[model samples]
Target chain A: GQQVMQIPQYQHVQEGEDFTTYCNSSTTLSNIQWYKQRPGGHPVFLIQLVKSGEVKKQKRLTFQFGEAKKNSSLHITATQTTDVGTYFCAGFDAGNNRKLIWGLGTSLAVNP
Target chain B: SQTIHQWPATLVQPVGSPLSLECTVEGTSNPNLYWYRQAAGRGLQLLFYSVGIGQISSEVPQNLSASRPQDRQFILSSKKLLLSDSGFYLCAWSTESYNEQFFGPGTRLTVL
Candidate 1:
């Protein structure tokens, strides 16, 4: 099984501030996907990065994949109260190909 | 449009009781299904996944097991629930190509 480590288990920022979380894997990844789970809600897919050094943006959210495909990051600009939740990054291990290696996640709290 | 469903939005069970959680995806065929658990203040953990009917894969060894009786149905079961089993359980489905996964509303289980 592959392991993905996430940094800064939790963060708290004022509304309109910025937040970022990083996901790192020890091995190369076939693809990486990001998800967000609101308080007391299910997780929703945010984005997926397949190509190395790929960068994608959705509204105020930005996703980046490392050049080596073993790391990824999600950056939220001008966060809002709606952004308060847990953000998780899951990686598909090139070795296993079937199982997704999940990061511990970074829980964000936005204060107005 | 596709949707994923999970029943009993929340559950409270005594330790040692049997447990069964159902997950279903609509409007898709031959989808890849997955089961994940998120504990308090922790990240998402992959539990099981299925690629097709009657094909299931367990990512971790625990008191829980999973089954895919139909192409779009995935179920998680346990002979006896443990206190540690309490958490948020999520079911997700992705296309056969293994891209982003859409998650269900989730079920919060509390074992005492």
Candidate 2:
């Protein structure tokens, strides 16, 4: 079975600090997707990386896929109170019944 | 435009009671639908997914079962719920298996 491991299960940072979460897969992945869930809300899709060694950014958030396609990371700069949420990374393995392997996720807490 | 709908934003059930949750997608045809569960302060756990009507693939083996009677309708049911069944259930739809998913607001179930 394919598995995705995420690091820093929980993180607490000041309002102006930066935060990063990493995701690693046991096997090669066809693509990786990132999502965010607020305190009491459902997960929302943020972005997807399909190419190897790819990087994408949304304002203060940056996402990168490893060259081997086995790992990925999401970094947020100058966190805000609104950035408090759980961030999840899901990896799509074409060889694994076409299902996405989800990570345990990293919960981010920002202090104002 | 596309939208996903889930009924009963919140629910409370006793142990051994039967459970059913409904999810539907609008403005999409033959989209890939998925059911996920998240315990408090935990990550997303995929329960089931459907590629089309009557086609379902379950990820986790538990007291839960899923059915797709229509192309855009997905249902999660349990004959008898347990205390462990208490969690937030989310429904999501994607244009393809590897594409980004759009999630519904989700249903919170508390099993007593």
DockQ for all models, in order?
A: 0.70, 0.79
TM-score of each candidate structure, all chains considered together: 0.94, 0.97
* Candidate lDDT (C-alpha), each: 0.90, 0.94
True contacts kept of each: 0.70, 0.79
Lowest lDDT sum, 10 consecutive residues, model 2 chain B, at B52-61
lDDT of 1 by residue, A1-112 (tens): 4689998899999999999999999999999999898888877888889998999999999999999999999999999999999999988898777777788889999999
Worst 10 contiguous positions by lDDT, candidate 2 chain A: A92-101
| Cα deviation of B46, candidate 1, in Å | 1.3
Proportion of native contacts in model 2? 0.79
